[model samples]
Target: MYLTATLDEMTEAQLLDHADEVSRTQRKCEAQVLRIAAQTAVLNSPETIDPDVARLPGRERVVRFGGVGTPDVAEFAAAALGARLEISSGSARSLMADALDLMIRLPQLWRRVEALEVKASYARFVARRTRNLTPDQASYVDERVAEPADGRIPWSRFEDLVAGLVVASDPEAAAEAEQASAQQQVARPTRSTEDGMRGFFIRAPVPVVALLDGRVQWIADVLRSLGDTDGVEERRVKAVAVLADPHRAVALIEEFAQWRDGSGERPDVDWSSVMPAITLHVHTYAGPEPTDTVRVEGHGPVTGEWVRRHLGPHARFTIRPVLDIAGQAPVDAYEIPERHRQAVHLMTPADTFPWGVSTTRHHQIDHTVPYRRDGTTGQSRVGNYGPMSAFHHRLKTHGKWQVHQPVPGIYFWRDPYGATYVVDHSGTRRLPAPEPPSPAERAVARALFGLAA
Candidate 1:
């Protein structure tokens, strides 16, 4: 009835229900698409088509599709995927690689996706991340992340865990990658924008960026006080234009500083405090054989040595005291403790609901299992905690949506109609609901085997 109704005819709840149903189907279709792409690559593989066969110059289909001789770049296997998908050859190659990576390197994950237990996009993302890894390295990743059952809890906890594993798997390779990336530093002008604005793309070292950004902000703030009738950001753009004429820029900033000495207003950009303050959350690995790599939270993997070199000893450090997330004792009070909040954020960085990615920054830490009126003991504990946006927290508290944490961090969310989703560190995934038998099938079963209806 909901499906047959027009959009305007449906209620708010009905629209949400329809959306969930549509998302499940879309995931299933994504799996099929990956399979079809894999088959396309197989058909175009150099081994299959030009494997030292009749040495003839005319047999050039294999080369035209993908450079058959260069198996190192899997995209060269053929342009077949690109051609069929009506995409660029580069995009086609990346697609082919992802599909093959899922099929071959991570067969376990691939199977779970095809079974509709894991999300296809989730699997595809993991595939791309692990594509550079060797078979053994990929196997190490798959063994931990992939599971037979649908609601795997560790999936939530593997936040960039695969990336850490990939780096740990090969030290020399990580170092070489770091060196290669260092060689690719560039500065170039970008194409003009619709608003007649042009920009420069500068890939410089951290120190240079810190100095440049600090100077730009200093000038922008001066422009603001000088009655430049532009917004702060607009002033910042004009400040960059001032930077192009370095002598004039320096003179204006100097005059402002001399006059502002008596104005009694604290300067916006304090170079003394700002220059050395580089806030980073870097995770370093420990072993007898030290690795060159460290995982920066927001930034991708960068070498540990490079971080030490860039963020010199003068840079301040605040090493977070480690807490046992699983073993922490529950507090007696209703108000969530600061320590407990940190554990909640660290344990499950994102909201423990339907694919919501809000962490403590935008989330109000919630007790996943709501506190009872008469309850007093250990109700505000890390084991019972989740970070949710205010709106979503209200939804769970008031809406018919129900959540049950079978394990400490793994949450199973069920809607009113019994459609369930599992949420954790890896993100949310829908569970496959079993279909009930029709009346005719029940009758046939009863007659054939004398089973009870």
Candidate 2:
């Protein structure tokens, strides 16, 4: 509040200086946190324990972390840190490892961190990367990486520099690392599937991935020439998405090649005829000024301008009955009706669970209230359910998580941890925790759980 109050009075140059100074302050705070982590590791180190107590009865007491002679800690040390940091124990352990590595192996970088000459995050990133190196090798990186010419850490310049140094410092270790990295290929969906956007990550040899990207861009250019008025980047995304259907990708690529060789005019093709069957919820308004946006399943909503540009001005439209999301009559059948299911999907497009990032369209639509065999009247309806990934659905059913929809298009969930989360049009939000239990309640809880309170 103090600085922000004066921001409006400050000139642009003054604002810039203020931002830089605040950034340095933030960096200093980060350094303090890392210093604490390093100190905590020392306190938990095996050397702190008596030699006789090193072995309790069956196993060694202290956790041993290898490489660069970074200090080891008691197994529960990270857990204690994690509780305070609101992070996982594994993450806390990595933080401790990175801090100790910087303190012991890269003392030059640690000094830079403490002085606020470099960001703590940047220092820790280097520490993690250089952890496998010997003290001399780590110091070699510390001098170059920590002491940048411009007092700034730009990833573009350092990425290659760090890689070259790592290889040059210890060739055999670098080779082993590269060999290990080659085995770590993966292909998976990403968490960016909100509001009909999608992504799939594929890691392979550089050349193969490069070619795929090149081809997708080529298709996007073709789409532009064909009067698809979306931005080039957006067109590229659509082009890549079409690759899921090999036949369509091939057709589009061939058309692109033909368009490249021809007069370069917008093709007079019916685009929708070539595209997959899309459920477009083009709900028309009775008001004088009707809305332009049409809600299309799988792709969310698009404006009339977009529709005209992509689908062509003369393109025909099929005006399906607008599914009333709020008040669909409940059907007696236990199995969901296709139209009802479609309406539910339109209402809440993504999986209706806290932090359920990516689930395909075909994900299970779980009944909010369980459908009983003996239950008379509408068991399966629009308001009764929403989309859930198979895993989430099972978890809700069996893993002590409960969900209920008090209204259509909104879901409230309670987990085993006594936290409440709600999912609706604006997306998921964790409600604030309830008031703590009273002493009387605590006494009862202790008695019920047989706790030594």
Candidate 3:
């Protein structure tokens, strides 16, 4: 009867309840697995075996067996755990690292998971995010954010909170790290595939990527406006073709250099209108001393020195005070105000979907709830607005999909067929779907147990 019945037969509420149960059970199992993996690592240590039988020298025993100082011990542990768990050595090694980190550096987080007070995945999330932090800094984060008394928080909020704590712990260290990392930026040579497709890859500063993304999107939008109703891939191909043209390439270079030099005629391109504007925020220190840290919208914190060097004399500064909307009423308007739009863009600078599409380049500012469906366009709050790719926007508008924001920057989407999803900065998590059994499964069940198909 269980195998024969379909999930669609259950009500929405029932489905949700079952999904919650599944999620809880999965978290518990993950915690147990991590515990077992940690135990396995300990048991596989050379100390667990006879040192004399293992042929270790008397003085070398402590270093080789006691500590994770030797690669051979790690390899032995990985091999042992992999064989026991029927997994790859690489996977076992990763598990061992996470388990050891939890046991050693993040005892509080590990305790929370062991007690089932926090999800194992969230514990791992904190561990991974704080891996680069000093032990003292990691402990500080673990103490404050390992287990919220109110229960689980969204991964996106957790990340932001951790990042804030990390920067606050040592701003100078963060700035130095950022500057050092910036030196590694490079654009690799283009590669051609066997299928005759070419790929270009770049590892650069966020601001540089933002500019290039905006330019490509602008070209694509222009081509689309000129009655080029091609698909997304085709339109992007055409946009690159336009950019690669000798005339347009030379013209763009000359115009940009002129603009930079402040002596040539400015191009008619309305940058803010065409693309999401890049915002650099410098926080004024209370004391008269200058600080190195500056916050770049969508890119987190950077050194003030880096910002100054990049912008040089071509920088235009905008001073906008943070609005206190506490006692103020929401203003109703047919169009979202520029300030409000910019606020929404800062909150969700990328496409809300799990797909790694850029909102700065090509996106639509959409109301989470339809305006016709009692969505108030007042003040353009972040909770009510989301940036979606054009394709996703159309799906939400006319494809019978429903979306709601239970919290700012977190979206829950229900498809036309009733499958639900939760999306955040980390990625998308699908809720339980009321799917029918596949024909093969049904057939096998029928043949084996005489169950109804």
Candidate 4:
């Protein structure tokens, strides 16, 4: 009876078609195995190994034993022998202590610091933010914290110092600071010299070093020529180009410059500080148009031309702008590429109410599920407090700011192009898609997995 039923099912054609599909999948898998084996044979020979690979000592031995199960004592020892340095503080106190330290060590860090006034100001900032401090941590506020000394490093300078002492000195470690000062200094307008061009800085985001396709050595050469200002210049310097995801673009230029040590390797630069964070939307235009201009109450009237010129043609080529203000373009302002506009929007206020926008206001457009948390809000904002992609709203009833929420990851989309993603507790890596799930895909996954019927 069982044999007869099986034969009948196969006869139905639909069931047979499913079986054929399974068979085809199995055959493809087998063919892939065969191809992999053939390639392995051809590629494995000593003659086929590149000269550089052959020259490496114990190259074959290392490759053969490369696994967590097989402990390579030599490799383990090599990694373990690297240097380690400790800084004192709780996670809460550390940022304060470290920031103060950076200011002391590298006063050039912040653009301005009145000798007495800024010192008191930063000390107060540190004191107010710290929570649940131990006695030692508390002492960092009142006792350990020293007033800014004459010519002592400011916030930016202190960041550079730590990058040098902590990151530059160690090969295995990653260094991070809130500011990159050297690049900003290089960007300063200066007198034209013998080089046919006045000095200009090319500070890229620090993470770009690992991301670019070209040789790291070539990058180092570029960095070395940047001069002591930590910037490199070409025959003609145009705009000081800065391309980085918002907020995550924190790191000082001196830290970036440190990649060129005795080894002479050029390091990627950080462009964050060079592009100052925006407080309010300023419109730019070729000329002022009546509807395209919006006067940000305290800021006077900002025209579309104002926004356009500041963005420049480079970013506008890719990012089209949308006027978040309800009525008009405010002035003869055209939309920039949506992506570039969002880049500006992420760090500034774009999604807030019409009357609420201003450059002087302090607010960061925050991701609801921060890129640090694995949430699906793309770099673009779509709806109002819709579980993701929340913007800064000044009103109390509008709801809480998104930055306050915890997430598995947080990311910023660059454009329709690739996304700049920062995984929770990991170094930032740019991926093709900011988040993995689409709404349609999510709905399918939910049904398939018996998650939501």
Clashing residue pairs for model 1: 65-78, 65-79, 66-76, 66-78, 156-425, 156-426
Candidate 4 lDDT = 0.33
What lDDT, from 0 to 1, does candidate 3 have?
A: 0.65
TM-score of each: 0.66, 0.48, 0.62, 0.17
Worst 10 residues of 2 by lDDT: 149-158
Off by over 4 Å in 3: 1-12, 44-46, 49-75, 115-117, 147-173, 190-192, 224-233, 245-295, 301-314, 327-329, 339-453
Per-residue lDDT tens digits for candidate 3, residues 42-129, read 6666555566655655332322221132222434667667778899977777677677777777789888888867777777766666
Per-residue CA lDDT of candidate 2, range 348-384, in tens? 7668887565435687988898988885788788778
Ranking by TM-score: 1, 3, 2, 4
Query: Best TM-score goes to which candidate?
Result: 1
Q: Kindly indicate the candidate among 3 and 4 with the higher lDDT.
A: 3
Give residue 3's error in model 3 in angstroms.
10
lDDT at 14, model 1: 79
Please give the lDDT score for candidate 2. 0.70
Per-residue lDDT of model 4, residues 206-264, tens digit only:
22322231223333344455443343433112112222322322232344455435445
RMSD in order of candidates: 7.1, 22.7, 10.7, 25.5
Off by over 4 Å in 4: 1-256, 260-262, 265-381, 386-453
TM-score of decoy 3? 0.62
Error of 4 at 12 (Å): 78
